[model samples]
Target: MTMEANELRVSESVPVDTGQRRGTRPMAPDDVAAVGRLFNRIFRRHDQASDDDLGRYLQTVFFGSPHYSPELGSVVHENGANGIDSAILSVPMAFMVNGRPTMARLLCAFMADGKAGAVGAARLARTMRAARQDMCFSDNASPVSADHWVAGGGIVLPIQSLEWQRSFLPLTAAAILAGRHFPIARSRVLVGVLRPIDRALRRLRPSMRPKTEGECRSEAARVEEFLQCASAMLERFAIRPAWSPAEFDWLVRVASMNRNLGTLQCRKVVLPDGRTIGAFLYFGKQDAAATVLNLVFEEGRERDVAAAMFAQLDAEGYAVAVGMAQPFLMNAISRQRWLSFRHRGYFCMVTRHADLKEAAERNDIYIGGLASETWSRLLTDF
Candidate 1:
């Protein structure tokens, strides 16, 4: 079902009929291939992405589950001769107000319909009503899609700023050398290092040390915990693979290439008795020299291990570190002296169905970090 431009034109002027029952349902196991195909079609049309990149994007979406319940997850399909002319996707993420699950951010979303906008809005309305209090919607605000949601009554939400990081430079050395202009040099190197690290680290597990007192005392304990959990779960947990069987190798390939970008460094955590309890991917160090990708601990150990890792880095005579605004984890790093905040600039826009005004009111959430289908797919390349 890789839709051609001519065929997609049929969906261009979607009917505005209020009674149309374009099926919007939870995505099933059988839906992965079709979903991947549709995603590729939309992204290729909009972003000029490559098939390889599109495959990677689909891999992230359909990996390892019979159904994805990202707090906000659904698929919309039209009943046409071709079947399912449009689609929408949502991933659930929680945001806290006073440490409560006050918001649910829609991490991924897509839509294809002109006439059934009302029906789509109604369904999202129902979904939002069922979600937590502070509901947030996020997606790439495409001109066409933005107009559609606006017509359906959804308002745009603003984002604070966009932030990103990579392990292309050791902040300590960078500061000693350049004084201030480190990131400019670091970004270029990250792109260059991706291929080489990708070839290595697949079988290498660096030595890790136990927590020191400083780490035990820091607020980063929470972040350390989560990092540990994510690592353990991703390893040896033996869940069914989420992405297409054919694409796993490609995911691995891309990951290998991007390893030096420091996005997938994970470490296993063992209990005192030597029981392998958890693991985590590490994050937050802009290291050009260490050759370590972003690291993660077991989800639950992020906060704890982070302080320990930082203490270790500082004790080893590292001078400075940069903390990107990566929510809770980075927030923890910002509190430490060896780490300082680096500011980057960009704003975000959120879009959702306009007719779901009541649901928006009830959910009271905002979505951010959403890229257009094009950009989202394109991200797979890097």
Candidate 2:
């Protein structure tokens, strides 16, 4: 039942050193649970997340409608034990430039099963050899086992740009925005925390009477007003395409995922004018002092609407607020109270390649595009 030399076709599409002893075997569907558990132990343990939530997250990323490819993934075990000790998952993405096609492997995740089998040096070497030619990658905030990745010969470098981390507890969005040295060009909209608001609403529900029908109508009108403002902004510049409800739903779901990981919460921002112009997803623990998340606005409305929204959130008492700031969003996040979050908050370990690095840098700007070699192992069985 052993893999024979003839059957083991060394993938030439990518360059990797196969001299290492352990070889990659494609992950099987049955291996998904074990893979999930491994990830849960490494990343979700501290979050105190329920098994159901973790399972749901895994299902969405791995078993949902669009299943990840097991062929591009592998589970590395010292010997042929059915239970996986380590795993690597990857997906191929074609980036077109100047009418030319460039193929890159998006590493999903890599995980080791609590050091049970203890990933061997040979396993790492072989996997790296296998992935080298294909431009294998990993993300900055991945929960992958870093030790194994380094053993596999992957070097951590400033691929694409970098992952920046900001602590909402220590500062306010106003401070970050106001920092003169912060990259105004890169700044975007501010996402404010609604933690206090959500908790207060719940606590005061019994004592506080519900708003009257007229008041309810007026509130609904505000949501519509914001929506109108957002729509108008989109029409003016035509920068970002109009957002569909489906996209908002996806945003909401992603927000929930973040909440499980940390203290962030998300809410759709409704303006007094009766429109839902934008959404702010908060990140931070409720018990913590601040919340930080992204505020996405309809492209052209960044200046007028997003600004007003942040001001409102600030007045409402939610602390630390921050937003993605690229040149387009500079005007919104650049302010006296907003402090600039430091860059290099996250990093990706990738095979050294000039062109691939450039693509990764651009992908860093968007959600779900960061490539990390650790992703390969974590998502193999997905």
Candidate 3:
């Protein structure tokens, strides 16, 4: 069957709520246009995308995925005017828990229109959490959304929510950080003025330089090669994604499409004998901050992997390197004086299974990177 026809059949299977003008229902292919409008109204008000563009994105991310599950599909709230005012985008994922295959729902890009849809939004969130999936979680939640998740019996993971940064050029990094809030700081003239100061500061603090003395070296890797390295690195974790080769390829391809973040770079750290010990992925650009997407290493190889990754970023002229702080890498990050940590958002999860909940609370399970919603273009693209 054609993709559109398959989607329509999936939508028809879901029972519609016709009793009320304002109610939540399973999001269908037909709802993409309205959901796109609602998304722009809430998250992209200043720079709204054309309906056609948004429709294509929604289709690719939600409907086109091989993992899409109708029972755990996205949800939309209908207003009195038969229009959508609230939405919660969900991407179904397969995971391995204690050697058993489990399904999960990764929530992303939630939105509600002003006061009119506030309650509806909350209800929609609750609806998603209450789905039949083994677990539901999000790593890109705002403080408001975090509170809602907590209120709905979800646990807020303190460790997974923190972000770490290592600055190679302090002055330039500061300006780029400030640019997020002030446009003037991002001006070419201001950036040009800071560049020289950053050069002097780097020379003044030789001890702060990222260490590159490890015997391991990073080699550019294809997505499939990274997956092989990742599989070896993540086997120790009790609960982790169990994506098929095709699903993983699709995920990485979608992640690479976020041009706003810069070019996607993937590399595998290997020993002198060519044994792969680690792998890292990130978006990098010259004179700008590089955002790490996933960084995994074998036990006790954190320092080697981290050193190689940062050395490469520094050599590429990135002013700073940042990513979600994984608990296992905390010691390596702390040893570097140039690296710092900051709380960004809450990584919250909801699950009835006690083992899964405890494992997550103790930081035994992996939660960020491919497991989270950071790969979505909706976050970085207009």
Best by TM-score: 3
Residue 219 lDDT in candidate 2? 16
Compared with the true structure, model 1 gives a TM-score of 0.41
In model 1, what lDDT does residue 38 have? 60
The whole-model C-alpha lDDT of candidate 2 against the native structure comes to 0.40
For residues 249-307, could you state the per-residue lDDT of candidate 2 as single tens digits?
44334334543224434445445565555654444433322233344566555555444
Arranged by lDDT, best first: 3, 2, 1
Q: Rank the candidates by TM-score, best first.
A: 3, 2, 1
Q: What is the per-residue lDDT of model 1 for residues 1-382, given as tens digits with 9 covering 90 to 100? A: 0111232222323454565534545455455556556655665444233355445545565443223342234445555344454565654333332223222334355644446445543454333332222333444444564454445444443222323222222332443335234545445564355424532532242211123432143222343343334433434222111233333233333344443233333344454554443333332224332222233344465555555555444433323333223343555444444233333332222323232334333333222221112113333332
Is 1 or 2 the stronger prediction by lDDT? 2
Which is better, 1 or 2, measured by TM-score? 2
- Give the candidate number with the greatest lDDT: 3
Number of clashes in every candidate structure? 66, 67, 0
Pairs of colliding residues, candidate 3:
none
- lDDT preference between candidates 1 and 3, better one: 3
Clashes of 1: 66
